[model samples]
Target chain A: MPKTLEIRKLHVEIEGREIIKGVDLTVSTGEIHAIMGPNGSGKSTLSYSILGHPDYAVTQGEVLFDGENVLDMKPDERAAKGLFLAFQYPVEVPGVTLASFLRTAVNSIRKKQARWGGQPLKEISAIEFYKRLEEKMNLLQMDPSFAQRYLNEGFSGGEKKRAEILQMAMLGPSIAILDETDSGLDIDALRIVSDGVNALYGPDVGLLVITHYQRILRYVQPQFVHVLVDGRIALSGGPELAEQLEEHGYDWVKDQLGESAVTRQNG
Target chain B: MANALNFNRREGYLEKYGFHDKNSYVYRTEKGVSSRIVEEISGLKGEPEWMRNFRLRSYGIFEKKSMPGWGADLSGLRFDDLYYYVKPSDKKGRNWDEVPEKVKLTFERLGIPEAERKYLAGVEAQYDSESVYSSLKGIWEKLGVIFCSTDEALKKYPDIVRQYFGTVIPPGDNKFAALNSAVWSGGSFIYVPAGVKVEIPLQAYFRINAESAGQFERTLIIAEPGSFVHYVEGCTAPVYSTNSLHSAVVEIVVKEGARVRYTSIQNWSDNVYNLVTKRAFAYKDATMEWLDGNLGSKVTMKYPSIYLMEKGARGEVLSIAYAGNGQHQDAGGKAVHIAPYTSSRIVSKSISKGTGRSSYRGLVHVRKGAHHVKSKVRCDALLLDDRARSDTYPVMEINEDEVDIGHEATVSKVGDEQLFYLTSRGLTEEEATAVIVSGFIEPIVKQLPMEYAIELNRLIELEMEGSVG
Candidate 1:
C-alpha cells in the first residue's frame, strides 16, 4: 500500500490560544497541495504543529502518518519518519555545517527505512552522499561551497530557500512541507526554486507547498489547493480554486461566513 | 627526577621545587605583609628610590582594602603564612645552558622552552619569583618593539612606565589590583610602535615550581596608533599540601586605531588561589580581544574587562572554562562604553562536571555620554551530572535609548541519545563524551591558534580521564 498522511480533525494550541483548530488534511503520494493564507492565519502554525515543535500542544486530534500517531514522536523522530518541514526563516546553527547535518539526518532516515526491509541499507558511504549532494546542488544552481559552510549562517533569503530544498532532495522524505519558500525571492530565483520542487515531485514523495501568493503555484502545479483563513481551511478545491481565489480575493469567503463569526468559528 | 622524589613526600607532582621548605632558600621574608616584608622584597630586588616608594604606597592601599565578597571564597586563603618571595636560585639565567638544573628540569617537564623554540616568536619563562630566562628573538627587537620583563622596562623605560602605569587601571581600582601593585614581579612589558603589526604572537609561561610561595606577576601591553599585536599568558602551579597564591595583574592600553588580543589558558593545582585582575583600555577606532581558558583552580575570581573610551571602538571576550571536583570557576567579562558608537560582545562557555560549579557574572554598562552603543552577550553552560551546577548573572545598564542589546544563556547536559549514538558508532564511553565535549567547546577552540587548540584538546582529554567508569 502507498503510505499516506491523514490529519483527522487536528486541533493545536499554544498556551491558551488555538492556532490549528479542527484542521482536516489528507496528503497522498503523487500529489502536491498548495495552501494559501493571509498573514497570521496560522499557516506556519499548522506546519510546526505537525512537525512536533515542543511549543504547539495538540489539544484534541490525531495526526496519522502511515497509520502511526505522530504527536507522540519527538521532532527528530518525526523527521526520521519521513516528515520534513523547510522552515520559513531557516535558523543559523553556528558550528553545524550543511554536510554534517545532512549526513546525520540522511543516516537517521536510512535507519528508519531499514526496519521494514529484508536487508539493511548499510549506511551510505561518505563518497556516495557527497556525489548525490553535488548533483542536487547543480539542479538548484546552488554553489557546492555551501555544503561546507555553517548552515544558513549569513545566507541570503533565496540562498536559504535553495538550501532547504537541497535538504529535502538529499534526505528524500516521504512527505515534505515547504513553508513560505517564495517569500523573498526574485523572479529568476523563483523559477529556479520551482524547478527544484518540480523535479522532486514524484510518486515516492508528497508535498505540502505553503505560501501567501499564487505566483509559485503557476510553475509547480498543485493537484489540490486549499485557502486557509484564520486557522481553518475555509475554502478547498481543485487547482483552479487558486486562480479564482487569487483573482476574486479572500473577502468573498469572509462575507459568505460573517467576518468575526467565521474567524471565531475557525480561529 | 631523583631530587623531585626525595624533596618531600607530602607535596604532589613537582615535589622538590617548592619554596615551602624553610631551609631551602636564603634572604626570605618573615610571616606577614607589613612594612618589613615589603621593604624586604624591595631591598632584595635591589632598591631603586622611585620603585621602592611605589611599592610602599601600594602596600598601604593593599592594607586599607578589604576582601571582595562577590566571586570566589577567600576564607581559606592564609595571607600571613604565604611566602611573599623566593629567589628560585640566586640569579637570573642569561642563557638556556646557565639555568639551574632543578629549574631546568621543571621547564623540561612542562615542555616550555622547546615550545618556545618551535612556535612562539618570542618567549619569557618565569620560575618561582623571577624571570629565569627571557631571550626574545631579534625579529621583534628590530621592529622597535619592547618585549621584556616588567623589571627591565622599569629600568630601561622609566619615563614610559611613569606616564602610562596606573593610568588605565590605578592601584586603588580594586583589592587585588592594589595587592598586585604592592609586590608585582616577572611579567611581560610590550610596546608596539605606530602602524607596526606583529605577525607572530609573543608569549610568556609562568610556572610555579615552588610551594606556599606567592608569585605576583604584572603584564603591561601598549599598542601605539594603528598598530596590532597578540599576547598570550599561560600558568600552571605544582600541586601542594598547603595552598599557594598567584595574584597577577594584566593592564593593556590600546592606543587610538590599534588592536591587542590577549589569550590565557590556566591550569593551576587545586590548592592554589588563582585570583587575578585584568583590564584593557581601547581608544577611538581601536579594538581589544580576550580569549581566556580556565581549567584547574580551587577558587578562581577573574573577569577580564575593557573600557571603550572613544567612538567606533570594539571589544570582544571569548572564554571557556572546565571545572572538575572541588573547584569553582567564577569568571566573566565586563565592557564599559564611555563614548558614543562603541560596541562589545562577550561569549562565555563553561562545563561543570563532578561536583564543580561554574558561574558567569558579567556587566555591559553604557554611560549617559555614550550614545548609540551596541553590545551582545551570550553565555552557555553544560552541567555533566547530578552533582554539577551552573549559573548566569548578566547586568546591563543602558542609559542611552539608541542601542541594541541581546542576551542568551543555555544550560544543557550530555543527552543519553547523543552519547548512545556516538558509542553505537564504535566509540567507547570516554571517546563519545570526549567528542561531545570537544564539540561543546568548538566555538572557542576554533578561535585559538592551531597548536594551542590541539594542546587544549589533549589537556581536556587528560582531565576527563578517571572521571567516569
Candidate 2:
C-alpha cells in the first residue's frame, strides 16, 4: 500500500482566529501537489497544522497518515512517521553543527523505525553518516564547509533553503511539504533547490510544493495545483493552474470566487 | 499540553553519585566547632606550633564572623550539627594498592585511577576529610615538583608551606574561608620549580560519604618564577536526608613570569552545601586561569578571584553553572588589578531548569595607579522553562582613567520556535532542550580538555532528562 496523508475537513485556527476553514486535501506517495495562495489565505497555516505545530490548533479536523489519526501526535512523532515540512524561515540553532544535527535526526528516525517494526537497524556510524551527508550536500551544490558551520546560523537566505533541501534529502521522508522554499531564493538558487527537489521526487516519495509564484514549478513541475483563497481551496487543476495564477496573479482566483468570499476581515 | 515546562527528575544524579559507603573512619572529632576542637585537629596532624596557633586564631575569626547575608540563602546551613573533622585513615596512601580496600573501591567506581593512568600527571584521592591515596609521576618529582596532600606538605615542606599558607586569602577573608582555615585537610599542595612546565594536569578527587559531615579541604599551589602547571579537581558526595557542608579554600601563587591553570568540576550531591573560597595572586608578567564548573549542590556560593599584583600580569576565568530542580548556583569570578598593564577576562555560562536558579555575581576593580588595564566580563544564561530563573549582579570599581573595561549579559528562555524546530527534525522534547542548552554553553565547554569536555556535556544531558512535560 502507498503512503498517504489524508487531511479531511481541517478547520485550523491561530490564537483564536480561523485561518484554515473546512479545508480538505489528500496527498499520496509518487504524486506532486502545489498549494498556492496570497499572504493570509492560510496556506502556511495548513502546512503547519499538518505537521502538528503547537501554535496551530485544529479545532475540528482529523489528519490521518496511512489511515491513522495523526492530530494527536507530537511534531516529532509526526516526523518519525515519515512526514517533513521545510519551513519558510529555518531557525538558527547556534553551536549545533549542520552535520551533527542531521546525524541526530537521522539516528532518531532510524530508532523510531526500529521500534515501529522493521528490521532492527543499527545507528549509522559517524564515518558512514558523514559520507552520505557529503553526497547529499554535493548533489544540492552546497559548500562542504556548511557541514561544520552552525545550523543556519548567519547563513544567507539561499543557503538556508538549500540546507532545508539537504535535510529533506537526508531524512528521506515519504511526504515533504516545502513551505515557501522559493520565497527568498535567487534565480540561480531556485534552479539548484529545484534540481535538488526534482532529484528527491520518485516512486517512493511525495512532494507538496507550497509557493506564491510559478517560478519553482517551472523547474520542478507539479502534477496538481490548488489555488487557495480565504482559507479554502477555490480551484483545482493541472500545472497550468499555477501558470494562470502567476500570469494573472491571485486576484483572478479572488474574482472567480467572488469578492464577498475572498474578502477576509484582516484583508 | 498546556504545561510544557515541568520539573526535571533527578534520578540520574541519584543513581550516579548518591550512593554512600559505610562510615569507616579512623577518627572523627565531636560534632560542632570550638577552639578546643580546632586545637585537637591541629594536634592530631602534629603540626608546628605556629601553624597550631594559626588554626586557633582562625577558629576565633570563624566565631566572630557571621553567615553571608547576600547570594543564595544560607540560613539552612547548620554548623553545630556537622562533624568538624573526619579522618578516613591514619596516614596517606603512597599508591593505589596501599589505599584501604573500601576507599580504593570508591575511587575506582568514580574512575579516578583510570583517569590518572590515562592523562593525569598526579592523582590525589581524598575520602571523607583525609587524603587516602596520592601518586605523582617520577618525571615531575625529578624536576623538583612536589605534589602531595596539604597535611603532608606541612610536614615535609614546612618552610614553603609557612611562607604561602593563607598569604593569598588570609584566614579572616570571609566566614567560610575562616572555617576552612580552621578545619582544612586533604587538599592538594603542589609546587613547580622555576622554568619547569608540568605539561599534564594534576588531578584531585574529593568525596564525602558520612552524613552531616563538614569536609573543609585547603589547596595551595605555588608556581615558581617561569614555571607552569595545570591542576584539576573534582568532587562528589552521597545523598543524605540531612545536609552536609563542603567549604574549601584554594589559594594559588603565580610568581614572576609563571602561569597556572586551576580547573574544578564540582558535582557534589544535592544534599551538600558547596560554599567555597578560591583566590590567586599573579606577580609580574604572570598568568592565572580558573575554570570552575558546578553542576550539583543544594546551594553553591563561589566566586573565584584573581589579583593582578604586578605589572604585565594577566588572568582569565571561564565558569559554567547548571542549576536543576531545587538547586541554586551562585557562581562567578572576580578580578582586581592593582598594577599597571594588567588584563583579565571572565566568561560565565549558566543553565536553569525546573525551579532551579543561577546567578552571576562578579567584580572588576582597577586601582588608582593601575594605568593601561583592560578587562571584559560576559555572562550568558539559558532558562529551560518559565519557572526557572537567572540573575546577574556585576560590580565595576574603576578608579583609574586609562583603562578599558566591558561587561555584557544575556538571558534567554528556550524559545518555543527553537524547540519546535528541533523536534520537527525528529528529536524528542528533552533531547531538543538538551541540544539548545549544550549549544548555549559550547563556548566554555570548548575551553575544557577533551575528556572533561565530554564529561561536562554528558552531565548536562543527564540533568536534562525528563525536564519537559
Candidate 3:
C-alpha cells in the first residue's frame, strides 16, 4: 500500500489558545499538496501539530501515518516513521559539524527502520555517507565547506534554507513538510532549492509545501491547493486556485468566503 | 523513546571506574592526623633528617590553619575521621610482573600498562597512598632524565629533590597544601637535563581503594633550560559509604627557554573530596601549560596556577569540568604575570546536570611594572537541565600600564529549540543532549591528546546516558 498521512478533525492549541481548529486533510505518497495561508492563519501550527511538537497540544486529533496514530509518538519517533519537517527558522547547534549531525540523524532513523521491520538496515559507512552528502550538496549548489561548518550557525539566510533542503534530501522521508522554505531565499537560491526538491520528488515521497505566497508554486507546482483562513481551510481547489490567489491576493479568497473567514489577527 | 530514563547521578559514576578490589594494604595508619602521625609517616619512608623536620614543621602549619571558608562546602568533610595514610605495599615494583596481582590487575583494567607500552615514556601506578609500580624507558634514563616516585627520588637524587620540592607551592600556601606537605607520598618525580626533550608523555594513574582514607601525592617536575617534558595524570576512586579525601600538591619549575605541559584527568568517586593545589613557575622565555579535566567528586576546589617569573615567558590553561547529580565542581585556572612581555590564556568549560552545580573561579593578575603583558580568560558553561546551575567568578588584578587583558563568560542551557531541532532529525532526546554537550566542550576536548580526548568523550557520553526522561 502507498504511504498515507490522514489528519482527522485535528484541534491544536498553543498555551490553551486554539491555533489549528478542527482541520482535516489526507496526503498520500506521490502527491504534492500546498497549504497556502496568510500570517496567523495557523499554517505553521498545523505543521507543528502533525510533527507532535510539545508546545502544540492536540486537544482532539488523530494523525494517522499508514494506519499508525502519530499524535501519540514523540518528535524523534515521528521522524523515524518517515516524517520530516523543515523549519522556517533553523536552530543553530554550535560546534556540531553538519556532516556529523547528518550522519547521526541518518543512523538514528536507520536503526529505527530496522526495528520497524523490513531488511535489517546497517549504518551507512563514513565514505558512503560522505559521498551521498557531497552529491546532494552539489545538487543543491552548496559549498563543500558547508559540511564542515557548525549546523546552521553563522549561516546566511539563503544558506540556512539550503541546509533545510539538504537535510530533507538526506533523510529521504516518506512525507516531508516544507514550512516557509521559500521565505528566506533569493531568486537564484529559490530556483536551486526548488530544483533540489524536484530531484528528491518521486513516487515514493509525498510533499506538503506550507507557504504564505505562491512564488514557490511557480517552480514546484503543487497539484492540490488549500487556502487556510482563520485556522480552517475555507477554500480547496486545484492549481488554478493558487494562481488566482497570487493574481488577486488572499483578500480575494477572504471576500469570496465571507466576513467570518477573515483572519482573527486582522480582526 | 518512551522508555528513555532520566539522568541518574550515582549510576553513571558507579557504573564506570567504581568497581573496587579487596584492600590488601601492608600498613595503614590510624584515623585522623597528629604531629606523631606525621612523624610516623616520615619515619616509615626512612627519609633524611631534614625531610623529617620538614614534615614536622608542615604539621605545625596544618594544625594552625583552619578550613577554607569559601568555594564548595566542606562542612561535611571530617578531616579527623580520615586515614591520613595507607601503604598498599612495602616496596615499589619496577615492572608489572613485580606488582601485586590484584594491584596489577586493577591497573590493567584501567589501561595504564597498555597506554604506557604504546605511547608513554614513563609510567607510575599509585595504589592507595603508595606507588605500586614505577618505570622509565631506558632511552630517557640514558638521556640523564630521572623519572621515579618521590620517595625513590629522595633516596637517589636527594639534592635535586630538596632544591625544588616546595619551591613553587610551599606548605603555608593553604591548609590543604600544608596537610599534603606533611603527609605527601607516591607521586611522580621527574627531572629532564638541559637540552633534552622527552617526546612522549609521562603518565601516572592514581587509584584510591581504601574507604575514608586520604591520598596526598606530592608531584614535582623540573625542566632544565632548553628542555621539554609533558606529564599527564589520571585518578579514580572506588565507591564507599563514607567520604574519602584526595589532597595533592603538584609543583613545577620551567627554566629559561624550557617548556612543560601537565595534563590531569581527575575522575574521583562521588564520595571523595578532591582538593588539590597545582602551580608552576616559568622562567625567561619558558612556557607552562595545564590541561585539567574534572568529572567526578562530591566537592572539588582546584585552581591550577602558572606564575611567569621572567620576561618572554608564556602560560596557557585549558580545563573542563562535568558535574553530575549531587556533585559540585569548583574548578578554574590562575595566571600571575610578574614580568614584562609575558602572556597567558585560560579557557574553562563546565557542564552541570540534575541538581549539579559547576562554578568557574579564576584569577588573572598582572603585577605593577609588568608592562607589555597580555592575558585572556574565557569560561563557557552548559546546563543540561533546569535543575542544574553554573556560575562564573573571575578576578582580574591589572596594576600595570601598557598591558592587555580580556575576559569572556557565557552560561547557556540546552535550549528546547536545539533539542527539538535535533530530535526532529531522528535523534532521541538523550542522544541529542549528549551531542550538544559534546559540542559545548569541543574546544577543551580538542586540545587533549588523542587517547585522553577519546576517553573524555566516552565518559561524557556515559554521563549523558538516560539524561532525558
Best by TM-score: 2
lDDT score of residue B436 within candidate 3: 94
Candidate 1 residues A1-267, lDDT tens each?
Answer: 567888888888988899888889999877799899889889988988787765688998889899999888766567767788887877665555778667766765666556546456668799999999999999999889889887677899999999889988887778989899999999999999999999998998899999998989999889899988889998889999889878877877677568768679889
lDDT order of candidates, top first:
3, 2, 1
Relative to the unseen true structure, what is the C-alpha lDDT of residue A230 in candidate 2, on a scale of 0 to 100? Answer: 86
Where does the lowest 10-residue lDDT sum fall in candidate 2 chain A? A257-266
The DockQ scores of all candidates, in the order shown, are 0.04, 0.77, 0.76
Task: Pick the DockQ winner.
Answer: 2
What is candidate 1's TM-score against the reference?
0.61
DockQ of 1: 0.04
RMSD of each: 10.9, 5.2, 5.0
Per-residue lDDT over A91-203 for candidate 2, one digit per residue giving the tens place of the 0 to 100 score: 99988889888888898888777777766768999999989998999999987998999889999999999999999999999999999999989999999999999999998
Ranked by DockQ, top first: 2, 3, 1
Query: Ten residues in a row with the worst lDDT in model 3 chain A?
Result: A257-266
Compute each candidate's TM-score over C-alphas.
0.61, 0.91, 0.90
- Write down the RMSD of candidate 2 (Cα, Å): 5.2
lDDT of 2 by residue, B1-469 (tens): 1133222336644443333333545788899999999999999889999999999899999999988888999888889999888776433333544434544443443444354421121122434223332234566678998887788889999999999999999989999899999988778889999999988787664222221123788889999999999988773322232338989899999999999999888777787899999999999999999999998789999999999999999999999999988999999999999999999999999999889999999999999999999999999999999999999999999999999999999999999899888888898888888788888888887878777777677667756766686
Superposed Cα deviation of residue B199, candidate 1 (Å): 1.1
Candidate number that wins on DockQ, 2 or 3:
2
TM score of chain A per candidate? 0.93, 0.95, 0.95
Q: Candidate 1 chain A: worst 10 consecutive residues by lDDT?
A: A111-120
